[model samples]
Target: MTNTNSTKTIAVYGATGHTGGYLLAELRRRELTPVLVGRDADRLRTAATAADLADADIRVASLDDHDALVAAFRDADVVISSLPAYVDHGEAVLSAAIDADAHYTDLSGEQLFVRRVFEDYSARAEAAGITLVPAVTDSNLPGDLLGHLTSRRVDGAAEITISHHSRSGGDGSRGSAETVLASVDWFREGGWHYADSGWQTGRPPVAELRYPTEQPRPASKFPLTPVLTIPRHSAVSSVTGLLPTEFHEGLKKLTADVVAALPATPDPASDLHYDLVVDAEGSGKSVRGVLSGLDSYRDSALMAVEAAVRLAENTTKPGALAAAEAFDATDFLDALAPHGITWRIEEL
Candidate 1:
């Protein structure tokens, strides 16, 4: 089921935003031209021009413009979405993809939205014969891949913990900030975690964690998309995702003013380093693994593009799927070798 054509046309729904620009640039770097779709024609033009994609095709369509949106994706092989607050905009674009019979992927980190995609749209996508993969970015996939890798080494892996650490100091991308703000109530209400053979609620807030380089920090239990993703393939009885206490508190206190004050662009000179440590324990033994990467946003862009390319080339089952479930863990990480992402499993 490989794509016989030399290039596959990918439609990017939010191709004018910051991360969308990276996706466009990555597509161009790989010589796969993209159809730029966004609400602002001028912003799309400006982004394409800045990315040196002056000749790329551009499509202007709002999410509400279902006819135009469907038309934009009609000729494409896949659609990669960078839209934020996905709970609001995701369904429309996903519906467009299904209507167009195109494979779909996105960078959504919202847990509820992820679950909805699987529950509500999986049957439709399967019937349409198109794959739908949500949470295809760094926020979830890296830890997901590590957890799967760790679980593969430990038989009857009953518990898995994913811890995140980053090197940068300021707020993350604007899309991320907006998503966090949109889901503030969910975060405060204590998000869901997988435990006790089913979804659990109201878990403890924080726990002590020893990172690879830093001392012990009070990591807060943040129910990221991994809680839904990891359990899709692994037989882990429980999964917990945590963020640094400082980062988690800052996210809780994020105001519109703070989001507005965040830099319009990331500091290029200041490298963003992300580390994920996954501990899978069961059957009286344990296995641990670590994954480290630079530039979470750019890595996600690369990941989205790579996943699109692979879907266009390989035979992918049609259904709602997680990143690790959709792609081979080791092969996917190896494909990211050129981007300076590394991982390893350790015996314990």
Candidate 2:
């Protein structure tokens, strides 16, 4: 709660989206200035007004307008890409942030987009002397950090198994709904996992999990984004990610009609909780790390903002990086405790 600053400015692209509203408020709550940047002038103005960011800057910039996008980010210490579908509309913003000399982070959870940032932008970001951290939301960040911790418990991690368990109190944001619906094609393919010394597709060697009081249940073999993220910074030989079978089916069920019926932004009354767990085993020992928090979308904003603020300090690893590589995993995780996030590691 003591992390407040008004001197540093953060430009938020897609400031009118469902998560954007929460992101803006968090920035202002920290006393950091927010620059509302997006394609729609009217919508940006409304979001700025709602956040009570009267003295904040509002720059209208479309992703395609490279010059405009660069100009929009020129005055900021860090840029938070708040877009719903990063795979579809992420590159331009990332590229522009590099051109503008601004540190960058985003709310991306898509495996493809996160991987793209690493493969395509790593060298460019290093050359620009700016950090680009993709997919630092509840999905990837916690697991990556926790996986690192869990791996450290043993001699080294031969493999790490990750899982996502989420609870939403009511109908969530329409943007989330639309994004999931749009991503149905490849999202279910269960993106790449590292094994046999390299990335692989199809069935992965995932260990059966019995987290805490819960029993091992049928989980859908889906892309656990950390599968792509963890190996980047950790010394793990293999990584696997999955979700509960019911959650996978629910993702398939999110139709356009259902998205239309959802709220434009997260309802203030509804509660959200997320738990990301990683089990790493090697050298005849096993350790598990769990990171839990409330309000998925809102806490995601906190994660992105924290990443941005940390990147602004210029202490993170330079270049496109995973959450663990971007910051001191233990320290960053500890800083989030005041925000209802609790984390721990234990040996079995």
Candidate 3:
């Protein structure tokens, strides 16, 4: 890890988006200057100003413009990409990070994209001695924390399940909406599944467990954090993911209506608060952890920011990584405690 006083700079791509806005604020709060990069000049300027980072430089570039992206990354000690998970754009961002020879991190959950990077970019990043961490936010962090907690009790875990719940109030950002839509299309095509080969189709529902709550919400299958994290962690043989079936059905209903009313602005009435519960089981016993909070997008940005700052300070290893592999899991979770994000654990 590098010293805080080194005056090194970090660049944030997609700086004009909602999560990017919060990320910029976090950087400013830490007295770190972050270069804001986005396709929209006006929005970038506005976001930079809003973060009280008027002195920070704003660069205009899109994923299609390879040269501009490379230029934007040049000289950056670290590059934090809050870019939405568009298949094409995601690859371009990774290319830019490689071109710049800077450490890279992003909030992405696209399984295909993640696999490509792991297979293709991992060696490149290692050769450059720069880190490339994907799924740095909500998708993977909670499960990683759960894995860490479970390891203390058992030698290995056989299966794990993760579930998410959010209040229906806050609106999704443009980026989030796009990512969700893409994921929906992917799932519709049976693009994700678990198999003996790992994350393949034809695997049946792992299990249906009731969330330990007064409401006893039922969870449905979803592809997000666990699909990627479980395979990465050798302690676990397999992982399955779920979301409240009611929440999934509710979202499906809203998406149907929204699709019918295309070209019109999305209705914000369906937004809500969110929560997550993760359970891990092994040969002898099991452990469960719950993390409940508000504003999923904001929380994700906060997580990314804290992790990015830690990366900039060289508080973690310098090579290809993920949230659990790069940052100190316990320290990261402890930091979130002051932000109204609480985690409770139990042994069963």
Instruction: Give the better candidate number (1 or 2) by TM-score.
Output: 1
lDDT digits (tens) for residues 263-321 of candidate 1:
76676776688877887888888887887888888888888999998877647899988
Q: Give the Å shift of residue 106 in candidate 2.
A: 0.3
| TM-score of each predicted structure versus truth | 0.94, 0.92, 0.87
Best by TM-score: 1
Which tens-of-lDDT digit does each residue in 29-84 have in candidate 3? 87888888878889889988898997988888888899999898887878888876
Candidate 2 is scored at a TM of 0.92
Cα deviation of 237 in candidate 3 (Å)? Answer: 2.5
Each candidate's lDDT (Cα)? 0.82, 0.81, 0.69
Q: Is candidate 2 or candidate 3 better by lDDT?
A: 2
Which runs in model 3 stand beyond 4 Å of their true positions?
A: 1-5, 169-171, 189-197, 206-209, 247-272
Rank order (by TM-score, best first): 1, 2, 3
RMSD of each: 2.0, 3.2, 3.3
